[model samples]
Target: MKRGEAILVPLGAMIAGLLVFGLFCAALGLNPLAVYASIYKAGFGSWYSWQNTLVRASPLLLCGLCTAIPARAGMIVIGNEGAVVAGGLGAATVGLATLSLPPVLSLTIMALSAMVCGGIWIAFGAALQHYRGVSAVISGLLLNYLAVALMNQLIEGPLRDPSSFNSPASYPLTPDHRLAYFAGTHIHHGLIFGAVACVLAWFLIDRTTFGFAMKIAGGNVRAARLAGLPVGRLVVIAGFLGGACAGLAGMIEVAAVHGRANESLNAGYGYSGILVAFLARQNPLVIVLVSLLTGGLLASGGVLQREHDLPDATIAVLQGILFLFILLSDTLYGRLPFFRSRTPEPKPHAIAA
Candidate 1:
């Protein structure tokens, strides 16, 4: 695909999605224009709204990486939810255990533990794909359910804090250990972490020899093997990097937003990230922009419900529609006349000759 098509196709699909959503809303007797205006105002019109969008985007950036990275290695791993859950569990376990240690050392340990746990979680799926010829997609989907079940068991049993009553949760981190916000804003340092991760990931995937190898492998595994590229190793490494990003996202939720690991850690950021990755065509830098847009859409959910008497799942429906449109638009690649290369016809002088 041409660079211009890369940008324009997704943008055009998004606009189509909005138009379809508007029709859906109009069918329900809601003014589509008012609904759109409300979404804009609630998501990006004010400083407060921007903060909310950024907060939501932070985790999405990392989660989107979970899918984006492995895609370069020709793996369709969708276990980001599993990786996030595992990371959260790892972070909470370490955080509770190191309560007596210095804040810096403890936080570092927690972060490392989260990354390791998450990497292992997703890497397992890649290992299955490489060794057993199992489908990464199936393994990843199953792993997501398994991770959620494991987390529920641990949080409700062994890791449950005695003080927690209504909701099951692990011990909370101390104020000093929790992630601090930007000077005067609700936005936490996790946003910076996410942004940095995206940049580093982009560099790794777009500007490195390793990335080129992965691209070659992804394009043709048989050719990659003939060329002596370690396709298995590349697959595992990509899975690990992707899962590590997701794990860090889980850690951020514990340290910055939730203050502990619980059901809240299972919020659909992982799934939403799959959408973000697809929308951005798995480009890390593009993922950042897509995350922000998705975050804005999510941030407006509450306002949509409150102002229009729409259900809480209204945003979800819109997301589903958008995803469908994006998938459909994929068929247009190389098929669109504007994006296709023009072939010059042979001159008539040949006939005269």
Candidate 2:
């Protein structure tokens, strides 16, 4: 698709989604405009709301990258939610273990451990796809279930902090281990990390030889192999790098927000990330903007429930409608005249004979 059409497709899909949502609201005897107003107010009307949106966007940005990167290699990895939990669990364990260490060192350990664990979690699916010929989608999904179950068992069993009896969570990190917030805002440095990761991912995918190879592999694996590309390695590395970003997100969530691993760590950022990636058309840079937009939508859920007397499921319905439209819009890409390649007419016969 042409760049202009690529951009327009998602916008058009979003418009259609909003129309559907409005129709649904009207059917439910509610004012769609009023619900939309509440969404805007809760998401962007004030500095506080902006902060809330950005805070939610932080992890979403990374989780979007988790799926976006591997997508370049034509791999569908949907297990990032599990990777996030695994990463958070790793970070919490490391943070507590390294309590006596210097802040920088402890934080480094926590971040590394989280990334490694998360990377491993998703890489397993990639390996299965390459080596065992298993479907990545199936493996990735099953892995998510396993990760969630494992996280619950650990936190509620061996890893549970006695003091957190009510929550059944790991012990909180020491104050020094926690990430500091930006001045006077609920936003933490995790936002910076997410932004940087997206930028770096953009550069890696758009400017690096490895990224070029991965794109080639994605486009045509047999051709890439004939061209001497390490297709298998590229696929695995893409999955690993994607998961690493997710892991970093988990680390930030635990170290900056929750200060430990808990059920709250499974905040659906991973699942929402898939939508963000699709909306962005898998562009790393665009993922950041899309994440913020989706984050705002998610942030408004509470306001939708409280102010409009709507159920919490309202957001899910909207998201589902949006996702449905996006899928439909995919077929519109090359079919649009704006996206179709133009061919110059053949030159007139020289000098009219």
Candidate 3:
């Protein structure tokens, strides 16, 4: 089952998701294949479609880290969306406040500040877990609510743009300050950052001493502590790293996509990252792949809405079904015959003897 779980299961589940969608479409008297074709044309049929998918997936890739990386140490960090908002604000604030700085210098400061914001956000949950025995899940979710409220307050009050009598947002970043898209491509450097981060995370979690420590601690915290591993530090660092991913996502949104912090800054990339992490089974590289897949769906949502008269709710329903099925299947891995442990067979009855 583990072997099956590696790829085949996910593929099967995805097929199942499509079948479920077909069933739903039938009930609604719509053609499921037509809708799916629309999704394909809008999401992957052209360079433009692929670019949009990558653009959207870039944040999700980082946001996925916000959940998957920490999960290595048994932490359920879900406040990535908040970290994203805070990170974007941090980047924007630095960019706006330091107009005299070189672009590289300013961008560095902005990205670092955003990371700090995200790190601290998850650190709060870690602190609660270490000191108070509070559930990280609850604390993280509550932190999300607080973060959203804080974002609202900041955009509506302290950070409100004075010039544009339009949407509530912080002062926009200067065009010169925005990250440049590669020539002939809409995808920005955030996709590069997300890829780098995912690779780094794979190294940290699967190839290093820290990774070994997390494996030990995550397997048995008590035994790990007895073995002199700094379990607390591992957990805390994992949580912090998770938060940093979210924060970096925010920075990307502000510096590359939106050019400012605003209400839309918390547009649920964080939440979607959670879904991606679950789908990837918390594997960093797999998270990137899953993010791209989901990003394609997201990219198609607009076209699905406009061209086919499909409501946004249609996409939402698809996402819900996929997420629900993926998570539900997680418990079944390692238990099936295809994944069952293999033991050496006892020597055949000594026919030779």
Candidate 4:
């Protein structure tokens, strides 16, 4: 596809999605233009709102990498939700257990625990695919349900803090171990982690030899095998790396935002990250930008509900529409006439004869 069309087609779909969603708003006797403007204001108009957007985008950046990385290895795992929850639980467990340790050591242990737990949770799916011939997608999706149920069981029963009677939550981490906010903003250090992770991911995928092997494996498993590449190992490593990022996202949510593990950890950022990955065409660098855009849209949901008298799900519907259009437009990438290469017409120089 031509470079311009590669970019324009997606933009066109986004525009189409907005127009279609506008019609839906019109049916409800609301002005689409006003709604769009409100979304912009609530998400980015003020410095405070920008901080909120960045705060939300932090997890999204990590979670989106969960999908984008595995995709590079030709896997379709969507079990990041499970990884996030499990990671959060693991972090909480470790944090509470090591409360007497030095603050920095305790926090480091908690982060590592979260990443290992999350990585194991998702890697199980890859293991099943490689060993048992089960589908990765099925295993990953089913694992999400299992992870949430397990988290609820542990949180409400064994992990729950007795003092937190009003809410089912784990024991909060000590103040010293909790992540510090950046300057005067509500944003925390997790944003830095997420940005650094994306840059690392991009480098690993584009500049490293292992990443090239993964691409070859993803493109053709048979060819990869014939070339003596360890396809299974690559898939497993990719799955682990992806899940680790997601797990870290969960850990950040607890240490930075919630201070404890609870049902609130199931914030759907995992699912939303899938959209971000797809929207960014699975490029780790682009995922950062797309995640920020998605985060803005999510932050605007409350504004739409309050000021416009719309349901909280209004943004979800628009997102769903946008996702649908994006999928439909996927086929337009190289198929559009503008994207196709053309040959010059025959020269008329022979007429001189």
Indicate which candidate wins on lDDT: 1
The lDDT of model 1 is 0.92
Query: Residue 210 of model 3: what lDDT?
Result: 90
Which sections of candidate 1 miss by over 4 Å? 343-353
Ranking by TM-score: 1, 2, 4, 3
Task: Kindly indicate the candidate among 1 and 2 with the higher lDDT.
Answer: 1
Q: What lDDT does each candidate get?
A: 0.92, 0.90, 0.86, 0.89
Error of 1 at 173 (Å): 0.7
Runs of candidate 2 with Cα error greater than 4 angstroms are 338-353
Minimum summed lDDT over a 10-residue window in model 2 is located at 337-346
TM-scores for candidates 1 onward, in order: 0.96, 0.95, 0.93, 0.95
For model 1, which pairs clash?
none
- In model 3, residue pairs whose N, Cα or C atoms come closer than 3 Å (at least 3 residues apart or on different chains), thus clashing, are 1-338, 1-339, 2-339
Q: Over the stretch 1-353, how does candidate 3's per-residue lDDT look in tens digits?
A: 35556786777677788789878877888888888998888889899999999999999999999998888887888888878887887778887997788888888888899899998899789868976899988898888888888887888888888875677888888888888898889899889889999999999999999988988877889999899999898888888888888899999999999889887787878888888998888999999899988898888989988877879768778888888777666666665665666795567877777
Would you list the clashing residue pairs of candidate 2? none
Q: Provide the lDDT at 184 for model 4.
A: 81
Candidate 4 regions exceeding 4 Å error are: 344-353
Q: In model 1, what lDDT does residue 297 have?
A: 92
How far out, in Å, is residue 281 in model 1? Answer: 0.4
